[model samples]
Target chain A: MVRQERALRTREALIESAATVFDRDGFSVASLAAISSLAGVSNGALHFHFSNKAGVADAVEQAASERLERLVAAHGEAVGSALQMLVDTSHRLARRLGEDVVLRAGFELSRDHVRQGGRDLYRQWHAWVEEALKRAEGEGALNGIAPEQVASSVVAATTGFEVLGARDPKWLSRRTVTRFWQLLLPQLATPPVLGSLVAAGGPPGDHARRTPGGSPAARAGEEDD
Target chain B: MVRQERALRTREALIESAATVFDRDGFSVASLAAISSLAGVSNGALHFHFSNKAGVADAVEQAASERLERLVAAHGEAVGSALQMLVDTSHRLARRLGEDVVLRAGFELSRDHVRQGGRDLYRQWHAWVEEALKRAEGEGALNGIAPEQVASSVVAATTGFEVLGARDPKWLSRRTVTRFWQLLLPQLATPPVLGSLVAAGGPPGDHARRTPGGSPAARAGEEDD
Candidate 1:
C-alpha cells in the first residue's frame, strides 16, 4: 500500500512538472526532459508513467477537466438563484484560472491543434454554462433573453478571459469578471430579479475565497483530478 | 518601375509563404528555410526581403492590420447607423478569417506569447470595437446597456470566435457569427433602432460576400493589403 501511494505521488509530481513546462512553453515546444528534470524523476520513470509527451498532456487535460467539473458541482450545491450561482461561479473560475497553472495548461493544450482527442475544456465549459442557464430558465429567473444565447455569450466571455489571461494576467482577475456580470446581469434579468444578483463579488452565501493575486502556484481552489 | 514592382511582388510572396508555414508550424518551430522553400525563393533572396522569421511575421501582421483598418474605414463610409456598420463589419471579418490564410496567420502569430512587442491584434481589435460601440452611443442608438460593457462582450465574442475557429472552422462561419449578432443586438439597441440591424446577412449595401465553406484560400473580401 505504501509503495502504491508512492507511485501515485510520483505520477502526480510528473503531471505538475509537465503543466509547468507546457504552460511556459506551449505543447509544441515543451520537452519531456524539462518536465522529468523538474519533477526530479528519471527519464525511464517518466516513460513508465507516460508513454510520450501526448500522454503527459492528456493527463494534464484530464486533471484540469476534473477540477472544473468539481467546481461546477460545488457551485450547483450552493443555495441561491441559478443566476447568482453562475455569477459566483464565474468569479471562482476566473480566480482559480489565475492561480492554477495546471488548469491553465489544460486549456492551452486543448487549444493546441497538434494535440488530438483529449478533454476539450472549452466544449465542456460550454455545456456546463448552458446547463446552468437552462436551470435558471426553468426557475423562471431569466428575463426574456434566451438561455442558449446567454450560454454562448457567457462561454465566449469566460473562454476569452482564459485566452487573454494567458498573455495578460489581469484578464483573469475577479474585478474584470465581476464587472462583466455587473454590466450583463441588468440586461439579462427582469427588474424584479436584478436586485438579487451580485455583480462585483459573489452570491451572499458563496464561500469562494480569493487567491493571492499574481501567484500561479497559490492553488487556493484546488482539487485532485 | 517594372523592377520595383517585381521586388514588391517577391516581398509579398515571401510574406505570404512565411504566413503559411508559420500558421502550420507555430512561430517557435517554423524555420526560414521552410518559408523560403514554400515561396520558391533562394536563401539570399529571402534574407534580402526579410531579416529573419520575426521580420517575416511582422510583415504579415502589418499587412493584415492594414486590411482590418481598411475594412473598418469602409464600414465607416457606408450609409447607415454605426450599429449597423459594426454588424456588417463583424460579418466581413468572420468571412475574411475563414477565407484568408495570411490574415488568420497574422492573428495566430500575434497570439504567440513568445513573440513580444509585435502588433497585438487582439488589443487592436478590442480598441477598434470600443470605438465603434462608442460611436453607436454618440448616435444615441444604444439602449440601457453601457457602451463599455457592450464593447467588452463584442471583443470577447469575436476574439473567442477567432481562437475557436483555429481549431474548428465552423466557429468562423458566417452563420455562427450572424447568430451571435442576432442574439446580442436586441439586448444592445433601443426598440426604434433594433429594426435597422442585420444579423444573418449583411446590410442592404454591405458587399461582404460569403466564401464557399471549407475553402481557406478563397479571398472573398480581399483588399490591396
Candidate 2:
C-alpha cells in the first residue's frame, strides 16, 4: 500500500513538472530531462512511468481531462437551470485556467502536433458546451437563438480567453469573463428566463468576488501572467 | 542601382524564408542557418541584412503589418456602413490568414514570449476592431449592443479561429468565418440596417468560391488547409 501510494504521488509530480515545461516552452521544444529534473525524480523513474515526452503529455492531458470532468460534474449538479450551470462552468473554467498550469498545458499540448492521438481537449470542451446547451434547450431555458450558435459563441469566447491569457493573464480574470457573460446572456436568455441567469458569472456566492467588470477587489497571492 | 535592388530582393527573400521557418518550427527553435539556406543566400549576406533571429522576426512582422494595413485600407474605403466594412475586413483577413504565411507567422511570433516588445498584432487588431465599431456607432449602424462588448466578441472569435486553424486549417476557411458572421450580424445590426449586411461574407464578388461550410467545390488550384 505504501509503495502504491508513493508511485501514484510520483506520477502526479512528474505530470505536473511536464506540464510546467510544456506550458513554458511548448510541446515541440520541451525536454523530458527538464520535466524529470523539475519533478525531482530520477531519469530512470521518469522512463519507468512514461516511455517518452508524448507519454508524459498524455498523462498530463489525462489528468486535465479528469479535472475538467470533475469541474463539469460539480457544476452540472447546480440547483437551477443548465444554462446557469453552463455560465458558471465557463467562469469556473476561466478561473481554473488562470490558476492551474497543468490545465493550461493540457490545452496547449493538445494543440501541438507532437501528441498525435492524445485527447483533443478543445473538441471535448466544445462538445461538452454543446451538450449543456442542448440540455438548456430541453429545459426550455434557452431563448430564440439556436443552441449550436450559442455553444459556438461560448466555446470561441472561452477558448479565446485561454489563448489571450497566455500572454496577458488579465484576459482570464473573472472580470473579463464576467463582462463577456454580461453582454452575451442578455441576448441568449428569453425575457422570462433572463432573471435566472447570472451574467456576473456565478451564483450569489461568487458574485461577491467578481464585479461587473470582473475585477477582484483585493485577492492576494494570485500569480501574474 | 542594380546592386541596391539585388540587396533589397535578398532581404525580402530572407525574410520570407525566416517566416516559413518561424511559422513551422516556432521562433525559439528556428535556426538562422536554415532560413539562409532556404533563401539560398550566404550566411554573411543573411547576417548583413538582419543582425539575428529577432531582427528577422521584426522584418517579417513589419511586412505583415504592411499587408494588414493595405487590407484594412482597402476595406475601410467601402461606400456603405462601417459595420459592413468591419465584416468585409474580417472575411478578407481570414482569407489572408489562410494564404499568407508571413501574416500567420507574425501573429504566432507575437504570441511567443521570446519575441517580447515585438509588434503585438493581436492588440493592434483588437484596437482596430474597437475603432471600426466606434465608427459603426458614429454611423448609427450599431444596434443597442455596446461597442466594447461587440468588439470583444469579434476579436475573440476571430482570434480563436486563427488559433484553431493552426492545428486544423478548416477553422480558418472562408466558410467557417462566414458562418461566424452570419450568426453574429443579426445581433449586431439594427433592424433597419440588418438587410444591408452580407452574412455570407464580403460583397457578392468575394463570395464566388465560398459556400456555407467553406468546402471548396472543384477549385483544385487552391491550397488545402
Candidate 3:
C-alpha cells in the first residue's frame, strides 16, 4: 500500500511539472528533461510512468479532464436552477483556472495544433455549457432566444476569457466574470426567472484563491517535507 | 517602376507563404526554408526581405493590421450610428477572418507565447469594440447596461468566435454572427434604437467569400499570369 501511494505521488509530481512547463514553454517546445527536473524525479522514473513526451501530456490532460468533471458534477449537485448553476460554475471555473496550472495547461493544449487527439477540455466544457443551457431552456429559464444561440455566446465568451487570461490574469478574475454575468444574465433569463438569478453566485473558498505555488501537486510536495 | 513592382510582389509572396505555414505549423515549428519554398522564392530573396522568421511574422501582422484598419474605416464611413458600425464591422471581420490567411495568422500569433512584443491584434480589436460601445452609450443607444460591461462581453464573444473559428469555419459564418447580433441587439439597444438596428447588416461582397487561394498575395500572383 505504501509503495502504491509513493508511485501515485510520483505520477502526480510528473504531471504537475509537465503542466507547468507546457503552460510556460508550450507543448511543441516543452522538453521531458525539464519536466522531470521540475518534478525532482529521475529520468528513469519519468520513463517508467510515461513512455514519451506525448504520454506525459496525455497524463496532464487526463488529470485536468478529471478535475473539470468533478467541478461540473459538484456544481450540478449544489445548484437548484440550471442558469444559476451556469453562473456559479463560470465564476468557479474562472477562479480555479486562475489558481490551477494543470487546468490552464490542459486548456492551452486543447487549442494547440501540435498535439493531435486527446481529451479536448474546451470541447468538454462547451458540451457541458450546451447541456446546461438546454436544461435551462426546458425549465423556461431563458428568454425568447434559442438555447443554442445562448450556448454559442456563453461558450465563445468564456473561451475568450480563457485565451485572454493567459496574457492578462485579470481576464480570469472573479470581478471580470461577475461583470460578464451581470451584463449577460439580463439578456439571457426570462423576466420571471431573472429576479431569482444571482449573477455573482456564492463566494468561493480559500481553495479558489491564487497562490505563488498553486497547483495541488505543489501543495502535496510541500506536505512531504 | 517594373523592378520596384516586382520587389513588392516578392515581398507579398513571402508574407503570404509565411502566414500559411505559420497557420499550419505554428510559430515555434515554422521554418524559413518552408516559407521560401512555398513562396517559390529563393532563400536569398527571403533573407533579403526578412531578417528571420520573426521579421516575416511581423510583416504578416502588419499587413493584417492594415486590412483591419481599412475594414473599420470602410464601416465607419457607411454607417451613421456607432452601434450600427459595430454590428457591420463585426460581420465584416468574421467574414474576412474566414477568408484572409494573414488576418487569421495575425490573430493566432497574437495569442502565441513563442513570439513577443508585436502588435496584439486581439487587443487592438478589443480596444475598437470598447470605443464603439462607449460611443453608443454617449448616443443613448445602449440600454441600462454599462458600456464597459457590454464592451467586455462583446470583446470576449468576438474573440471567442475568432479562436473557435480556427478549428471550425462555421463559427465565423455570417449566419452565426447574425444570430449572435439577433440575440444581443435587443438586449443591448434601447427599445427605440432596437427597432432601427439590423442584426444581419448589409451583405458582404464577393471579396469576402472563401477561396482556396484566398489571400490578396495569391490574387496578385494570379494577376502576373
Q: Considering every candidate listed, which one attains the maximal lDDT? A: 3
lDDT of 1 by residue, A123-206 (tens): 998898888898888888887667876776687778788888888887877656764665567657767777656665453345
Worst 10 residues of 1 chain B by lDDT: B216-225
Error of 2 at A182 (Å): 3.6
lDDT of 2 at B1: 100
lDDT of 2 by residue, A126-214 (tens): 88999988888898877655777677667777888888888788777765666566556655676677765665455556444554444
Model 2 regions more than 4 Å off: A114-117, A143-145, A205-209, A212-225, B205-225
In candidate 2, position B10 carries an lDDT of 99
The whole-model C-alpha lDDT of candidate 2 against the native structure comes to 0.76
**Tens digits of per-residue lDDT for model 2 on B53-153?**
88899999888888887877876464478887887788788788988999998888777764664678888899889999998898888776667767877
lDDT of each: 0.76, 0.76, 0.79
| Tens-digit lDDT string for candidate 3 (B120-202) | 88878888888999889999998866777778778888888899999898788765666667667776888888777766664
Q: Least lDDT summed over 10 consecutive residues: which range in candidate 3 chain A?
A: A216-225
Against the true structure, what is model 3's DockQ? 0.34
Q: Candidate 1, residues B1-225: lDDT per residue as tens digits?
A: 999999999999998888888888888888999999999989999999889878888998998888778867876565568887787777778778877888888888888876764787888888888888888899888875567767766777787888888878877776566656655676678778877666554444565365443122211121111
